[model samples]
Every structure is written in structure tokens, then in C-alpha cells.
Target chain A: EAEVAQSPRYKITEKSQAVAFWCDPISGHATLYWYRQILGQGPELLVQFQDESVVDDSQLPKDRFSAERLKGVDSTLKIQPAELGDSAMYLCASSSRGTGYGEQFFGPGTRLTVL
Target chain B: AQSVAQPEDQVNVAEGNPLTVKCTYSVSGNPYLFWYVQYPNRGLQFLLKYITGDNLVKGSYGFEAEFNKSQTSFHLKKPSALVSDSALYFCAVRDKGGAGGGNKLTFGTGTQLKVEL
Candidate 1:
């Protein structure tokens, strides 16, 4: 069973600092996604990537958050000058294809705690 | 805009009893619904999905979900619940109307099910 891999399962940082999370999707997956799950709320998609390019990032906070998937394999999400409100579980997921409604496989996620 | 709704915040069921976690969705076209389970400190695991065909779709961990188009619901069910089944369950849907193409899934608020022995 190929699993989505994530690094730095836990992270803590003071406000106004920078933080980054990494994700490696399952092999052969063509689409990748980043989601933020706040306390007591469901995961909200922050960005979507098709291969090496970003398809949608409308929900992401442009001033502080950014994500990239280079070579269409591994992805990195970075937060600059993190705020307390930026604390949440950053999840990475991938699907085999962007069409035909394929089910996504998720990573363990990196829990960010900004104080 | 596709969205999923999980009405109950929590559900309690005794071990060996039948269980059901309710889910409803709003979509523009034919819906592709899914159910996922998440344990503490872990990621969401795919359970099952409904794309087309039979309304009853069986999935992992002895779980199943029934799709009711008229009611616009896809509720997860288990014939016999176990203590190991206690976890946070989420329902999701892919936006059929969005122009961003495919592969975007919107999740529900999640339902925490506690199967007590």
C-alpha cells in the first residue's frame, strides 16, 4: 500500500516566525492538494496542483502562505511571519488523476502550533 | 459549489450494535461522494465512495454506505460496530460545477463516533 508521506509531524513556532511543511504523495498520482484543518472544523482546501503547476489557490492567503510542487512529486508549504491564527493541521493529499473523480490519499499531516 | 454536511457532531453506539453516520451534500451535477475515517493524530483514510451504479457501496473495515439520490444523502453504515470503530468520520464531495477541472474535494465538519463496550 503506497502511502502519502509527510515530514515534521509536529512543529511549534512563535508568532511572526516562518514555518514549512513537506509532503510526498503516492507514486503515479497526478494531482496534489493542500488543506488546513482548524480546531473543530473540517479540512479546507488551500491549494490544488495538477502535475507541477498550481491549478487553484483561491482559498490560500496570498500574503502569508505559499505552496509549491516541483517536478510534480513532492510538495512544500511555507508560511511567512506565521500568526496565531495560522496554527492548524496542514494536510497533503493526492489522487491518481484529476478527472473521473478519483479518491484521494492523505498524509499524516504536520500539526503547526503558533504561539 | 459542492459541499457536504454532517448533522451530528457526535454519535454514541454500543459495541456489536448497528451504526450509521449521516451525511448530506449539495452539488450541481451527478455527485461523487466519499467517506473517510480519521484516528487521533493521523490522516483521513478512505473508506468508500459512490460515483454511479449501485446505491449500496461496500468499503474498508466492514463498513458500507448507501446513496439516496432523492434525499441527497450518503450515510455510512456498519452491521456490527466494534470498539475499534471509534473515530472521527468525514464525508466529502467533489465539485461538479467548478471550472477548475476535477480532483477538488470539499469535506464536512466530521462526526465523532464512540463505540463503547
Candidate 2:
């Protein structure tokens, strides 16, 4: 079974530092999603991309966070001047298009910790 | 807004016993519900989904969920539990309304299931 890929399974950074995480969705999957999972909570959507175009980013904290998928195959999420509250498990997921009921495949996720 | 709720924060069960995790949802139009499991340091693993199908949906790891439309609930259940089944579980929903509504999923807080020997 094809799976979504993520890099830097774990990262530790001090406050005010910059950090970035990468993800590669399954081949042929057109919708990609970025989510943040806090301890003891479910994953929260940060951004959604549909073939290189952003579909939704209502929950994203734009002042410090940025995300991009230039070619639509892979994506990167960055935080400039990371804050302590930014510490969480960053997960990436992908699914086929035209079907909202399709199952989503999730990446292992990059756990970020800010000191 | 679409939302999911896992009423129980934690559920404890002995090995070989049946387990159930409660989930309720609110959506504007038809509801697309999903259940996922998360182990320590791992990502969310898809367990099952309910979308215009039989009320009872079976999924991986000997798990199943019953979608109750009248009650607006989709509860995850396993006939028999194992130690390996212990993990954090989440419920999510996608509401069909406008473009934004069906494009993204809203998740619940999550429920921790512990299967003890």
C-alpha cells in the first residue's frame, strides 16, 4: 500500500528559531493536508492543498506559519521564530479527489519541540 | 460548523473483553465520519469510515463502528480487545455544505483506550 512520507520524525529547537517539516503524498493523490496534534488532543487542520492550489487555511496561524506545495507532489511547512506553543506533532495526509468519502492516508508525522 | 465529540477521555477494558468508544457528530448536510487510532509517536491510522452505507461499518484490527443517523452518533467498537489495541482514538467528520465545509475535516479531542491484562 502506498503511504504518505514525512521527514525529520523529531525536532528540538529553541524559541525564536526557524524550523521546517517536509511531506510527500502518495502518487496520484491530489489533495494534501497539514495538521497539528497537541498532546492529549486530536489533529487540527493547518492547511489544505489541491493540486498546488490552497483550498483552505482558515485555522492556520499566518503570522508565523507558512506552507507551500510548489509542484503539488510534495509540501513543506515552516515556522519562522518558533514559539513554545508550536510544539506538537505535525502530520501530513493525502487522499484522492472528487470523493469526500474517500479514506485519507496519514504520514508518520514530525514531532516538534520548542524550548 | 461541523464537529465531532468523544465524550469519554479514557476507557479501560481487560484483554478479551469487548470495547466501545463513543463518538457523536454534528454536520450541516450528510455526514462523512471516520475513526483513527494513534500509537505513541505515530501518526493517525485509519480504522473505519461511514459514508452512505450500511449503518454498521467494519474496519481494520477487528474493529467496527455503527453509524446512527437518528442519534447523530458513530461509535467505534471492537468485539474483543487486546493489549496491542490500547491507543488514542479520534473521530472526525466532514460535512457537506459549501466548498469549504466538505473540503476539510473536523476532529474530536480523542479518547484513550487502555487494554490491561
Candidate 3:
């Protein structure tokens, strides 16, 4: 079975520092997602990508967070000037595009801690 | 707005016993409901989904969920619980009205299931 790939499984950064996480979704999957999972909370969507285009970034904090999926094969989520509240497990997921009921495949996630 | 709720924070069940995790969703238009499981230190894994069809939806690892549209509920079930099934479970939903909902999923808080011997 193909799996979603994520790198830098853990990161510790000081507040006000910049950090980035990477994800490579399964091949042929056209929809990619970035989510933040705070402790004891479910994953919250930060952005969604269709092919190489961003479909949604409504919940993403534009002032500090940015995401890109150039070429649509993989994606990167970056946060500049990280805040303490930004500490959480960053997860990446992907699924077949244009399906009403497609299953989403998830990556192991990168745990970010801001001091 | 679309949202999902897992009423129970935790559920304890003995091995070999049946188990059920409750989930309720609120969304406009037709809703696509989903169930996912997360093990310790791991990301969420897809379990099942209910789109348009019979209310009962079967998924991976002997898990199933029943979608009750009138009540706005989709409850996950397992006939025989195993220690391996112990994990955090989440319920999710997507609203058809939302733009490009085909890509985004809204998840519930989550329910931790502990199966004891």
C-alpha cells in the first residue's frame, strides 16, 4: 500500500523563529491537505490543494503561515515567527480528487514544539 | 458550517465484546460522513465512510459505521473488540455546499477506545 510521506518528524524552535514541514503524498493523488493537531484535539485543516492550485486556505493564519504545492506532487507548510500556540503535530494527508467519498491517506506527521 | 461531534471522550471495553463509538454531525445539504482511527504517535487512518447508499458502511479492520440521516448520526461499531483496536477514533464530515469539499474534511474532537483483556 502506498503511504503519505512526511519528513522532519519532530522539530523544536524558539518563538519568533521560522520552521517548515514537508510532505509527499501518494502518487496519483491529486488532493493534498495540511492539518494541525493540538494535544487532545482533532486535526484542523490549514490548507487544501488540488493539483498545483490551492483550493482552500480559509483557516490558515495568513499573517504567519504559508503553504505551497508547486507541481502538485508534494507540498510544504511554513510558519515564520512561530508562536507558542503553534506547537502541535502537523499532519499531511491526500486523497483522490473529484470523489464524493474517497478515503484520505495520512502521513505520520511532524511534531512541532515552540519554546 | 459543517462539524462533527464524538460525544464520548473515552470508552472502555473488554476483549471479545462488542463496541460502539458515537458520532453526530451537523451540515447543510447532503453530508458525507467518515470514521478514522489514530494510534499512539501516529497520524489518523481512514476507517470508513458513508456517502449515498445504504446506511450501514463497512470499513477496514472489521469496523463498520451506521449512518442515520434523520438523526444526523454516524456511529462506528465492531462485533468483537481486540486489544489492537484500542486507539483514538475520530468522526468527520464534509458539506456538499462548501466549495471544493471534495478535498477538505472536518473532523471531530475524537474518542479514545481502550480494550482490556
Candidate 4:
């Protein structure tokens, strides 16, 4: 089974520094999602993409956070001047097509810690 | 708006016993429900899903979920439990009438299931 791939499984950085996480979805998957999972809480959707076009980014803090799936195959999420509260697991998931009605494959996630 | 509720923060069950993790949802239009499990330092794993079905949906790893339209509930269940089953479980609902093309998934806080051996 093809699984979603993520990089920098663990990261620790200073509060004023920048951090980025990468994700490569399973082949042929057109829908991708970025989520943030805080400690003791469920994951929250930060941004969603459909074939490199952003479908939703209502919850994304655009001033400090940005995500891009240039080719719609791989994506990168970046946070500038990371805050302590941003310390959490950043997960990437992908579905074969639309998100309304199918199972999603999730990557192992990149755990970020800002001190 | 679509929402999922997991009332219990934790559920303890002995190995070999049947186990259940409760989930209730509220949605407009139609309901699409899902259950996922996560171990420490990992991403969420798909366990099961409830779309338009026969009210009973079977999924991976000997797990099943029953959809009760009247109660607006879809609870995860297993015939027998194992210590390895211990993990953080999440229930999610997709917003069928949501903005931005309508595919947003809203999740519950999560429930920790501890299957003791």
C-alpha cells in the first residue's frame, strides 16, 4: 500500500525562527489537506488544496503561515516567527479525489516544538 | 455546520472484552462520518467510515460502526479488545453544506481508549 510521505519527523526551533514541513501524497491523489493537532486535542484543518488550487484556508493564519502545493503532488507548510502555542503535530493527508466521501491517507506527521 | 462529539475523554477495557467508543454528530444536508486512530508521534489512521449505508459499516482491524440516523450517532465497536488497540481515537464529520467547495471535515476532541492486558 502506498502511504503518504512527510519529512523532518521531528523539529525543534526558537520562538522567533521559521519552520517548514513537507509532505508527498500517494500517487494520483488530487486532494490534499494540512492539519494541526495540538496536545490533547483533535486535528484541525489549516488548509485544503484541490490539485494545487487552494479550496479552503479559512483557519490558516495567513499572516504567519502559508502552504503551497506547487504541482499538486507535493506540498510545504511554513510558519514564520513560530509561537510557543504552535508546538504540535502537523499532519498531511490525501484523498483520491473529492473529500466529501472517501477515506484519507495520513502521513506520519512532523512534530514541531517551539521554545 | 457539521460537528462531532466524543463525550468520553477516556475508556478503559480489559483485553478480550468487547469495546466501544461513542460518537455523536450533527450535520446539515447529509452526514458523512469517519473514525480514526492515532498512536503517539504518528498521524491519524483510517479505521472506518459511515456514508450512505445499511446502518452497519465494517472496517479495518476487526472494527465496525453502526449508524443510527434517529440518534445521529455512529459509534465505533469491536467484538474483542487487545492491548495493542490502545490509542487515541477521533470521530469526524464532513460539512456537506460548507463554504469553499464544501469538503471540510470537523473533528471531535478525541477519546483515549486504554485496552489493558
Tens-place lDDT per residue, model 2, B1-117, is 888999999999999999999999988878989999999988889998888869999999999999999999999999999999999999998756534436577889999999999
Q: How would you order the candidates by TM-score, starting with the best?
A: 1, 4, 3, 2
| Candidate 4 accuracy as TM-score | 0.97
What is the per-residue lDDT of model 1 for residues B3-87, given as tens digits with 9 covering 90 to 100?
Answer: 8999999999999999999999999889999999999989999999999999999999999999999999999999999999999
The models' CA-based lDDT, in order, is 0.92, 0.91, 0.91, 0.91
Which parts of model 2 are misplaced by more than 4 Å?
Answer: B98-101
- Worst lDDT run of 10 residues, candidate 1 chain B, spans B95-104
Residue A36 in candidate 3 has what lDDT?
97
Query: Comparing candidate 2 with candidate 4, which one achieves the higher DockQ?
Result: 4
Question: Could you give candidate 3's per-residue lDDT for residues A27-115 as a string of tens digits?
Answer: 99999989999999999989988899887888999999999998989999999989999999999999886465747899999999999
Between candidates 1 and 3, the lDDT winner: 1
Worst 10 residues of 4 chain A by lDDT: A96-105
Report the lDDT tens digits of candidate 4 across residue range B47-67: 888888589999989999999
Could you tell me how far off, in angstroms, the CA of residue A10 lies in candidate 2 after the best superposition?
Answer: 0.5
- When just chain B is superposed on the true chain B, each candidate scores a TM-score of 0.96, 0.95, 0.95, 0.96
* Candidate 2 clash pair list: none
Per residue, candidate 2 scores C-alpha lDDT tens digits across A13-114 of: 999999999999999989999999999888888998988998888789999999999998999999998999999999999998856674778999999999
Q: What is the TM-score of each candidate against the true structure?
A: 0.97, 0.96, 0.96, 0.97
**Which regions in candidate 1 have their CA more than 4 angstroms from the true location?**
none
